[model samples]
Target: MARFLLRRLVTSVVVLFGLGVVTFLMTQVLPGDPARAAAGRNATAEQVAAAASRLGLDRPLWDQFAAYFGRLFQGDLGTSVVTRRPVLDDIAQALPSSVELVLAAMLINVAIAVPLGVYAAHRRGRFADVAARVIVLLGAAVPVFWLGLVLQLVFADRLGMLPLTGQLGFGREVPEITGMTSVDALLSGDLPAFGDAVSHLVLPALTLAAAFIAVVARTVRSSMITVLDSDYVTLARATGASERRVVIRHGLRNALVPVSTIIGMQLGWMLGSTVLVESVFGRTGIGAYAVTAVLQNDLYAVIGTVLVIGVVFVLVNIVVDLVQLWLNPRLRQPARGAAPAPAASLAPGAAAEAGPAVKEGAVS
Candidate 1:
């Protein structure tokens, strides 16, 4: 297990390094000059040249990339050409809102998808299954921005029940705990502020979660169906296990392996999808910042954001891999006679061997 973890960590680092190189190269190849963009249309040739020199844009692309990577290693993300602010600071400020939005969306996705999937699997040929399929199709077909606009119109304009824009109430100043307005409000014991934040978050979160929920539901339902037909499930049923118990215990637990993989991949999809959702909802987040950086040709900010997102993707996948290994005994244990146990395995054979068994039972 320790070796497995070390291998995964090393792989994650390599993947992140590759991502950084790709991002840096892509930004370098982009058409517009960052110095010119920073200087604006009214600036003279000498001004643009001076700005380029100041930003090291006048340096060779390879040298610039090397310098960028060097600074990155030291935790410096450089300054935004447009905002003139440290890219790291900009990301730090913007990341919390994006994280809050994505977290809420994922929560909504899991809450809806898991139950619907289980139900659809259990009622495979029934109307419930058909309805779930239809919902999934519609969710995937509709664009998030359109959904956001429609939701904003109905809930905010027509119903007049929720705020149309922003993260908080007009008069109340919500604390910025952890950078997530909703969490901060709750932490501050400001229930009213929390409620307001939740209200505003509802439309955007639902809009973002719709497609993810569809994907998760379908994946889980398929996995569940497969698991239900397995021998253990049949044996459970033969032993007079209750229908619900057989389905939830023997079936769902087995189905989690595939479902969890999909859930992990969905984190990346959710982050990518947030760009449009944030724009439509007028939320100030990393997505919005990324958009602004691209439009202004702020290469540093763009690269920094891409690097941050790539790191997030890699970390999430690593966590998922570890969780999967923990949940599935087959992943943590070697096949019989496949290889001799590592030294770490022998030190506490009795205790260490029990780890997989305990994890399996816990997950199951």
Candidate 2:
């Protein structure tokens, strides 16, 4: 386990380095003068030149790259071209909202997918299974923005069942603890504020979850079907184990090994999907932050956002690897060091000497 963790740590560092390099190159190719963006449209050439110097943009590419990484090592993500504040500060402020949103979407996805998939598998080939699959297909096929608009139209504008946009009502307040409105509200014993936050969250979370729920459910359904047909499941059934017990205890548990991997892989998907969802819902999350940064040609902010997402993706996959090791005992076995020497290739003298011992041990 220690070795496994170390390997993952090394791989994560490499992944982050590659992400940084690629993001830097991509930003360089973007069509706009970041110095001008930072200095403002009406600024004189002198002001733009000063801004470029201050931002290290006037340095050689290699020098600037080195400087970026140097500041990165010290936890500074440089200044945002648009905000004129530290990019790290902007990310810190927005990241928690995105985290909360993604987590909520993931929770909704797992809660619905697991049970629905299990039931669908149990009723495979029946009308229930067909209906479940159809629903999943529709969920996956729907565009996130269109779905968000439809949800907002029906649930917010028409029915007035939920808030139209934002994390909370205009004047509603919750103590800023975690930056997650609901969590912060609960921490402050503000149940009404918590309720309001959740009401605002429902539509966006649902829209974000719709894209992934089908993927997860389909994975679970397929895995559950395979597990159900395995020898152990058949043996359990033959032993008169209840269908629920056989399915839940024997099938679903094992099926979750693959499902966990899929769920972890979806972390990136969830984060990416938040871009569209946040825009439609008017949430000020990292996704929205990213969109704003791109529009304003904020080089530092874009780089910072990509690095953060890549780091998160790596961390989540590591956790998933650990979870898989826990769920599947076979994965916990120590890796084999080397192949044993073939008996046929052994020295004749050693083989003769070992043959009697082997025969005696077998007889005993």
Candidate 3:
């Protein structure tokens, strides 16, 4: 486990490094120059040049990379050209909103999808199963922006049941003790603020979660079906286990590893890829922050945001791996313990390290 975790950490570092490089180069190759963007349109040539020089854009690309990399190591994400604030600070402020949004969406998705999936699998090939399939198809087929718009139009604009925009009511302010609006509101014991926060969150969170729930439900349903048909499940059934116990304790428990893995892998996607949802809902989050950075041609902000997203992706995967190992102890063991490596299979250096071959039960 230690070795596996160490290996994963090293691989994550390499992946994140590559992500930073690719993101930096992509942002660099974008049409508008950040320095010029920082300088107003009315600025003279010398003023633009001065801004470029100040931002170190006048330096060689490699030099700029080195400086940026050094700053990254020191927890500096550089200053946002448009906002005139540290990119790090902006990210810090925005990250909580994204976190709150993603977590709420995932919770909603799992709460709906998991039980529905299990029930669909339990009644495989029945009306329930077909209905589940249709739901998944519709959910996956719907575009995020269109779904968000339609939701707002129906629930907010037409029905007037929910707020159209923002994370809270106009006048119902909650302390930012935690960055999450609902959480902070709840913590502050402001029932009205909390109620307003939930009202504002409903459409956006549900819209964001819809596709994810579909995908997860399908995956879970398939895995559960296979688990139900397995020999152990048959044995459990023969042993006079109740149908519910057989399904929940035996089938669902064995099937959940895959579902957990999928959910974990989607965490970053939920958190970082909700740009359209955030826009439609008029919520201030990392997604909105990144969108602004891109529109303003703020290369530093773009790179920083991308780096954070990449890091989150890596971290989520690590958590998934750990969960998988915890749920399936067999995953930690050698796949084929009956076979041992032959001397000829060893590389020259490994061969040198090997003293001699031994009998199956004998110590060398």
Candidate 4:
């Protein structure tokens, strides 16, 4: 485990380095003058020149990159071209909102996906299973922005059941313990504020969770089906274990190992997708911040946003790997210079052949 963790940390550093370099080049390629964007449209040519010099844009490309990279070590992300505030400060304020949004979406995904997927696997060819499959396909197929719009129209505009945009209703405020409105509200013991915050969150969270739900549900369904058909599951059934016990203890428990992996990987994708969701919902988050930075050609702000996302992705993956190790103890054993364990098949008496510890571990 120590060796694996060290390798992961090294790989994460390499990935972040590559990400920073690529983001810098991509920003350089964006069409527009960063100096002019920074100086404003009405600024004279001399002022633009001064801004260029101040920003180090007047230097050679290699010097500019060196300066930018060096500043990173000092925890300086420079001032945003649009906001004229430190880019790092802006990111600190915005990151919590995106984290809150993504976490809420993941909670919804797990709540719906696990039960729905398990039921679908059990039902197999029934009408309910077919309907679940169709819903999953549609959720995956629909674009997030379009889904957010439809949800806003139906739930907010037409039905007036939810707020149209923003994190809290007008005149509803919570003392900011965290940038996340819902969490801050609860922390401050403001039930009304918390309720309002949650209502605003419903549409955006659903929009962000749609694709993730589909992906996770499909994975759970498939994994459950495979586990249910395994030799240990069959032996448990033959030994007069209740059906629910067989499914939950022997099947779902083992199947969740792969689902944990899928959830972690999907989080990385969801970070990117949050851009569209926040745009449609008009939420002030890192995604919305990135959109503004891109449109205004704010080089430092854009790079900062990508760096934060990349770091979060790497950290989430590390946690997931640890969870996987816990779920499968075999992963903890070094594969090098180790004899292979015998694999069991689905044939009768395979559980007995595999040994008592293996049989109990499979079911317990």
Q: Per-residue CA lDDT of candidate 3, range 1-364, in tens?
A: 9989999999999998888788768757878767777787678899899998987889999998887678778888878888889999999999999888999899899999999899999989999899988987799789999999999899898999999999987867888987999999999998888888988888899999988988899999999999888755665565565888778877887789999889998898898768888998999999999999888778788888988988899999999999999887667985685765554332222233233322331364
Computed on alpha carbons, the lDDT of every model, listed in order, comes to 0.83, 0.86, 0.84, 0.86
Error of 4 at 97 (Å): 1.2
Q: What's the CA error at residue 24 for candidate 1, in Å?
A: 1.5
Clashing pairs in 2: none
Predicted structure 3: lDDT: 0.84
- Model 1 ranges with Cα > 4 A deviation: 39-41, 338-364
Query: lDDT score, residue 237, model 1?
Result: 61
In model 3, which range of ten residues has the least summed lDDT? 345-354
* Per-model root-mean-square deviation over C-alphas: 6.0, 7.9, 8.8, 3.9
- How do all models score by TM-score? 0.89, 0.89, 0.89, 0.90
By TM-score, the better pick of 3 and 4 is 4
Question: What tens-digit string does per-residue lDDT give for candidate 1 at 221-315?
Answer: 99999888765565556556588877876677767888888888888778867889899888989999999998877887888888888888888
Backbone clashes per model, in order?
A: 0, 0, 0, 0
Residue 339's lDDT within candidate 3 is 66
lDDT measured at residue 58 in model 3 versus the true structure, 0 to 100: 90
- Candidate 1, clashing residue pairs? none
